[model samples]
Target: MEIYETQEENAWIFRIDGRLDSNTAPELETTVFRAIENGARRMVIDFEALAYISSAGLRVILKTAKDLKRLDGKLVLCAMQDYVREVFEISGFDTFLPIAPTAGDALRQVAPPKE
Candidate 1:
């Protein structure tokens, strides 16, 4: 998968393209972990271009979520296709991880409230 990362304010956004399976999951895991280690707190994963996701991908997401939680950070996922959305639903990931309709929505969810 192609992972593109950008920053908006304090939030880090990752846009995934193609498929995420066992082979590609590690790449994503490493990259996101690096971001977190570098002190990234707010994260948004945009799955608009993602074609497929395997259990390994789910594992990476779950791990990242847990890590962020331990750091007192937050994560949001957005722009998922129908199949991907179904996968999260069937796996019950949607219940815990915030899934937004768009990247903008996700960014908003991760953003700190204005004064």
Candidate 2:
């Protein structure tokens, strides 16, 4: 998978393209870990271009969420296709992970509070 990351005013946004499987999950994990180590607290993942996700991908996402929670941070996932959403639902991830229908909605979910 190809990941394009950007620092927004409120959160770190990652737009993923292609499949997120065993081969690509490691890369995503590394990128996310590096960002968190650098003090990123809020994150939004856009899956609009992502074609497929394997259990390995789910593991990476779960780990990232757990790490962020330990740091008192937040994560939002959005733009998932129907099949992807089904996968999350089947995995019971929908119970805990925050999912939005659009990236804008995801961003709002993780947006920094106004001063």
Candidate 3:
């Protein structure tokens, strides 16, 4: 899988392309962890181009979310295809994790508050 990072105001957007299985999950985990280390608090993971996701991918996401919570940060997921959305639903992640219909929506969900 290919992960693309973009900065939108105070939020960081990570777009995932292709399949996220055991092999690619580590890469994603590392990338996200590095971002967190770099002080990325508001994040959005875009799954528009993602074709598939395995359990490993789910674990990475859950871990990221938990870490973000501890830091008082936020993570939003967006642009998921039907199959990908189904996986999240079946995994029961959809209940706690926020899923938006588009990247813009996700960004808005995690956007910094106005001063």
Clashes (N, CA, C under 3 Å) per candidate: 0, 0, 0
**Which parts of model 3 are misplaced by more than 4 Å?**
none
Worst 10 residues of 2 by lDDT: 106-115
* Candidate 3, 1-115: lDDT as tens digits: 8999998887999999999999999999999999999999999999999999989999999999999989999999999999999999999999999999999889888987779
User: What ranges in model 2 sit over 4 Å off?
Assistant: 113-115
lDDT of each: 0.95, 0.94, 0.95
lDDT of 2 by residue, 1-115 (tens): 7999999888999999999999899999999999999999899999999999989999999999999999999999999998999899999998999999999999899986778
lDDT of 1: 0.95
TM-score of 2: 0.96
TM-scores of the models, in the given order? 0.97, 0.96, 0.97
> What value does the lDDT take at residue 83 in candidate 2?
90
Off by over 4 Å in 1: none
Candidate RMSDs in Å, in order, are 0.8, 1.0, 0.8
Candidate 1 lDDT by residue in tens digits, 40-70: 9899999999999989999999999999999
Higher-ranked by TM-score: 1 or 2: 1
